[model samples]
Target: SGAPGSRVLITTRNVNVSRTSGVSEANMYQLSCLSDEDSWSLFKQRAFSGKSSDDYPELVPIGWKIVRKCKGLPLAVKTMASLLFCEFNKDKWEDILRSELWELTEGKDKILPSLKLSYHHLPSHIKPCFAYCAIFGKGHVFDKDRLVEMWMAQDSITTTARQCKEDVGRRYFEDLLQRSFFQKSRYFDSFVMHDLIHDLAMFICSGDCCEVVDGKLSSTSRVRHLLCRNERDFRRLLSCGCTDDLLKSSRTCYCVGDSMEPDDVDGAFFMKAMEGMFMKMKYLRVLHFLCIPEITELPDSLGNLKHLRYLHIYASGLTTLPESVGNLLNLQTLRVETPELNGLPRRLKDLVHLRHLCITGDFLGLTDSMGNLHNLRTLEVQSDKLNDLPESL
Candidate 1:
């Protein structure tokens, strides 16, 4: 056997740090959010296992939403899971879900702390990397080495890099990670913003340091939408002229080894990342993701929006849906094209105010009490796969 000194295996959320003085690594693994079934089951076990059958079926679904938002981060699930043990109704779960990072962790310093606490945990050198992210948009993912280079260029690191640059910045980044300030997105070695934590960053950037730092764009800058599906796509996003709307970008990069891969910004799944917004942001009356495909899910929160009249999710991967989707009482037109849809949510029966429902593909089951919605003027799903036509129709 070769000397053990020739190889060493180290695991870290950051890809940049994995590259060494003269060694290449293989078989790196990246993790994504849990499947809906697994997430729902996990939430049910910890949040509702003790409840009686007579009281659960109605409330269990709501718990599933909370788990989905946690994005399968065990740190987040367990922290909130234990806290949820004190509540009795769905409102409490919503309150927890709707809360900002500070709200959940406030006063519970023994349990969690405010940004000051999260910030305080960072070592002297790496504080800038966390703060440096303020330059990127909230929910934006960054290439690890590129970002680390920028962080090193910052005054904080240059002041310290001479002594031991890599270790200094890395230690700070790890500190921020330990304190739960930043999360690693699996596709590349990049970090992503969870909504609440991003809210915290935006809150900070909007406060005394608004001009100096912004985790999100401010009114001062023009809004633009950038959609990139590859590194060439990223270059395309940056190359476009500035505007005032939303700037979306997606990029797929190829690296010879794991150490060089960027995180979070998955070119393949970027469309799913944008699906929820397409349905909800009424301010965004006009939308488009025609450039790419591979999206599969929609955000259930969009159903509560009363002004929304037009919805479209015709992507190939959109095979399942949320039961909360039944609440779209105001929807006037719905369109989709998914080949593997197994069934419609039972709650679809509640949409009595609908006018047009157009699904042009196959589904395993499309019949149930849902046909009772007499208000339907047009229903156009594939007929071949229909398990049964509702007599009530």
Candidate 2:
């Protein structure tokens, strides 16, 4: 494929392949690992981007010890650097320095093993939190706020006396963010787990908590977190039909990536299949129907899911949620984008545990009973027909 002036530069871990591909010794470029000084410089640049050496005099020695273990590999150094970013506590730095994960491997493949050390040191409460991330596809950027709410829905976060459940979830997210498990996306307040980190999560979570229904619908009795790459993949699986036992215990059903365009398939058939699937997933705590405009309404049986915590209706279809939805007292986060929606159930006040609510619609007014939602933390409503604002608001 190379033109007269076009040059192809290949990067690989195998040297024999490079030789066989006609790369002579003169053309071969071997990348050597960084030296101790260079490694520390790179690590420090990422970990304490804005801080001067005088800012944290005590952490320098500890940082050096941690950097030395990186074995001069930039990836290892950068990974650890990102892990320690904005972290200034002496004890945490010492803990990393003393961790035995540094001794897991000896040579070129040391980066993964070093990264695993960080994973191994995660708190018991956050272990499952990290593992559940396998549900997301590679390079998937997630909204931090929504992500925390989803984790709360999955019951992956534990509330402490000083912090509310949402606050606790945020703390967990920060901890993971500090440890290099997540990296910032180009978009604001969005993040992505590095591919290596994602691989580690999948390896730990496989066959236990997360499963992606791609190309096939394998038996999923034990899978609590499920993901479908796109609407097309889901439709293909639906045509084959699902068994009664498949995904029966699923707590999260995420339809990620691209949505189905209006002309992609039979809309009625797609909606019918989705309704049936939702009915079988009675234990679902987190459900996401990403931009499926054909879904005009949700199943009334949706109220039977007492465990439901987070629900997202990105599709612009049905106007209002079924009144039975109020029966989900455990719901924590609700996001809907039904522009035609007219009103919310007066019983919405009964969702005493709800924390976040976002809806864009043609609503009239908030009922006085809205004051009864003592736990509500975030509320966003858009409507042109609304006149009166509740005194309680």
Candidate 3:
């Protein structure tokens, strides 16, 4: 399907899948557990949230005992360490050291019982937020602020009248980060969930969230959140008999083309599919597009998404946002990262409810009406053509 000498890389836990795919044994690779030294280093980094292990000499021995029980499994060690975070008492550490959860045999695909214990201990409000991440595929890199904004769009963050939702969302993100639910990615300012942790999230939200890969939908009737990994997956979604009703109930939809190759689908067909899909997802709260190089512009019908709160387009070929985008009265976050982009729509200044705006492109400057965005909390812009800030800002 690709040009001569092209290769496809596949990652999986099942050896049989690889063998069935015709991968030669000589080309196969197996990953082993972390070395004890590396495991301890990772554990200390998470458990103390950067505090030195020597400072808590008394707890060091108990920590090693807990780490040893983890069998050099990074996720297991981090889970147990996070559970012991901020606990100075020796008995508490010992209790976790002897938790019955560790005694349970590893389940299918090696879903460690320690991971389940970590999820069980998550705050009630944070549980759904974590589970909602099941919509993302394994190996997907996460943006901290973007993830929090999506949570706010879904009403996953709890806040009082005096508290700002953004603040609350940030707190929730930090809590998850500290608990090992998220780990830093090799890419700067990004995070990734361990494959095992991703599996746990999928298990937690199996009833409502669905992921479509290689044109296969896991669930249709009760699905509320959907992830379409490529053009084939999106096409499959459009051709599904229950599309209209399914789109109506969907709260979040992520169409990720980052993994797409140029030969995967014709550009025109992909755009046409996207335009048609947008018109049907009336109640969507969060919409994300990544590395969709064929997307030069968004459909005007995108503005019809009245309930949309978070919108992100990254590493795309987008040149301009439609003026109708301002019609999204509930939109809270808008991030566009594309060097090809020329400018923002003038009506963008009318989004009074917008809280975060990040743009990176060739734009010269912003419209003076930016002062109208009273609720704005974070503004980031990177442009070689930009000279000065608007007085209204």
Candidate 4:
């Protein structure tokens, strides 16, 4: 596609990817750390923006020391600079330069010390919101509203008397965005964390959040958040040697699937495994399944998750909710997106605390008792079969 003499440049953290692309060792180039002068220049540009370094003569010495600790890594330098951009305090700069986090030795594939310090410097309330992001995989695109709703479901947002939870959650997202923790995704209305930033989140959330991939769990610790990258990983987690206590301790479980749809046998296995898992995970606060494509029905035992607050399913084959769904007195948000679903549970009206309900299907089965859902605030239905609205609604 290029002129004969034109050269293609490829950059990647994984050497395997480079080799796989047919780049030989003779042609490969490993980047070295930047020189001291370059590092300082980059740091000064970010930390001072357009202002001259002379504007803050007192902090330049401390800034140089901090930049030296970054070892010429651009991301580390920029993150530390952003962390101190507006600060004019000498003591604050000195404190950052002398922090013990820098003394921590680097581990294989571990996050940079500067990134760790950036997370450490986050506000207390925003800390949990950021750490909770570890539940997602690297390169994951985040939806602002969906993430805010998830944070709300987890009680991560603290709202004032005048501000609603979504408003406060948006503020938290913007704060992170300003801090360079989240970058705008190429997709519209979405964002993504830099790979190193994602690593920092995973490192800080170590024991509390666990991710499963290729049938392997990142950690066996007692985790509150669990993520399965695909249906196979979820199945492996259910059938693997993981203890029942571990499942019982999880408060959030998210499963994301690829494009491949499951066969009849795989669907049956998935249903059986889900039933077994539902029986064990009693404390689950949020349950999400995206693109799994074979969930035709929910197990009755789902009602046993008395503490569940958020439930989301986006499978093409999902048909209906079990009647026991009404037992979730504390449930707040429910989102089911599928064209195959027939209707809602008849007892859904009993969930007085339900606030958000979104459904996409052929039949909604709305009843007069829907008026009992007095706390509902957001309602979205995508259906063509229904021609009339319930008077109670």
Best by lDDT: 4
Task: Please provide, for model 1 over 155-227, each residue's C-alpha lDDT reduced to its tens digit, 9 standing for 90 to 100.
Answer: 3454433565545556666656545566788756778755556555544433312221112223343322222
How many clashes in each candidate? 21, 1, 0, 0
| Model 4 misplacement above 4 A | 1-10, 35-45, 49-54, 160-162, 259-264, 290-294, 364-368, 386-393
Task: Write one digit per residue (lDDT tens) for candidate 2, span 10-53.
Answer: 98768998999999989999999999999999989878867875
Candidate 4's error at 368, in angstroms?
4.6
TM-score, every prediction: 0.32, 0.79, 0.79, 0.88
**Residue 164 displacement (Å), model 4:** 2.2
What is candidate 3's local distance difference test score? 0.83
Global lDDT scores for all candidate models: 0.49, 0.79, 0.83, 0.85
Q: Model 2 TM-score?
A: 0.79
**Residue 64 in candidate 3, Cα distance off native in Å:** 8.5
Q: Sort every candidate by TM-score, greatest first.
A: 4, 2, 3, 1
Worst 10 residues of 1 by lDDT: 250-259
| lDDT by residue for model 4 (25-58), tens | 9998899998889999988887886689998899
TM-score of structure candidate 4: 0.88
Clashes by residue pair, model 3 = none
